[model samples]
Target: MAVRKIEHVGVMVSNMEASIAFYRDVLGLELQGTIGHPDEAIKLAFMGAPGANETQVELVEGYNGGLPAEGKVHHIAFTVDDLESEIARIEKLGVTFIDPAITTLPNGARYRFFYGPDGEWLELFEPPAK
Candidate 1:
């Protein structure tokens, strides 16, 4: 079978409220909803852009210990039309950029990384226009 698109990325968080606020209020993603799994003692919050159908960021709660030191997964990246404007908007929310400036890949794509409320790494990527 051929691979399609990414469905979602699951992130284990210590505080669901803070995670939700960072992804929704600070990052401007909409909270689709939350699911409670009593058996697993977990709560899942799905978030994405308005009108987006694929690739959601799922915030997970009810796990023990703090955020992972380093997971197999590195960071979740979102594509944006205007990286500068997006960075400015997020900066206004008090999010600091990991890089001093936007980094350009050899292929000409631009990207930047930052930490979420729970110290989860996230990225903003912009591909060169066609």
Candidate 2:
């Protein structure tokens, strides 16, 4: 079977409100929806990009469960144009960047990595102009 696109990334947060604010306000993600899984005693919040994109970030909270890992899964990256502005905006929200903007690879593709509320890593990629 051919592998399809990723539906979403699940992240567990101790506080759902903070997670929502950080993602919605800082990252500019829209809170598509949220649901209460009574059976599991967990709440799931789905967020999507502002413009055009189906990829989503699922915030799992109130479970008091185990954490996956910090930087172990590495990070989930998304394409962005203004890395500087994005970084500044997120930093103002108290988010920390693991590594500031760095240019690597022979092609000199610009990219940066950062951490969210629960230390979930994320990468922002800015591709070379075509």
Candidate 3:
């Protein structure tokens, strides 16, 4: 009953540094910080936009990296202003696209899927302009 919005989405990564780079450099998220879990075997990294606290992305390392048949988390989608340009830019950075082409919804929203450092699916979503 207290849930208002998604606080964060946790993703498992094999290599924490690589995952951090992909999310920070490629996706442009700022590294909030990193901490070692109480268990000591697990390490975690938190990232989000520069000034916005909205939804944060948590990268978990030393967890089960062996994702199911689907993928790490099906895919973590980030909202973008210009889907086309963002796709092109990410593609230029050598990220492979899972979607053959951008998909447009009935409401005019557009989205595309790409891969993350750990073969995890990632998406860029563009909502219809108001």
Candidate 4:
């Protein structure tokens, strides 16, 4: 079966309010809404850009054992049309990215990684046009 685009990236956060603010204020993503899983003792907050498709950043809180040194998940990526322009814009917003230059994949896609508020890795990917 062919897989579709990524629906969302799950992130475990210690503080829902702070995580929500970081995504909403710092990254400028809209707060889609939040839900709680009583059985799991966790709350999920969804955030994404306005008019975006199903893609989202899912911030999770109330999890046990607190935050891990490194989350179980490595990183989450968002697709962009122009990698350079996007990097430049994000850099102006004071986001320091790890890779000084974008790395090209064998499939001709380009990518770079950066850290989120809670030290979670974030990525920007640009695939070759069809």
Which has the higher lDDT value, candidate number 2 or candidate number 4? 4
Off by over 4 Å in 3: 74-130
lDDT of 1 by residue, 31-98 (tens): 98776553367776889998886788878777544646666344576777788888888989899677
Give the per-residue lDDT digits (tens) of candidate 2, residues 48-80. 997746678878776545655552233466666
| Model 4 C-alpha lDDT per residue in residues 2-58, reported as the tens digit of each score | 123564687877788998999888999999877545335777778999878578887
The positional error of residue 108 in candidate 2, measured at the CA in angstroms, is 45
C-alpha TM-scores of all predictions: 0.49, 0.48, 0.53, 0.50
Candidate 3 residue-wise lDDT at 107? 50
Which 10 successive residues of model 4 have the least lDDT summed?
1-10
lDDT of 3 at 39: 47
Query: TM-score of the candidate numbered 4?
Result: 0.50
Model 1: how far is 34 from its true place, Å?
Answer: 0.9
Candidate 2: list runs displaced more than 4 Å: 38-40, 65-130
Better of 1 and 3 by TM-score: 3
Where does the lowest 10-residue lDDT sum fall in candidate 1?
A: 1-10
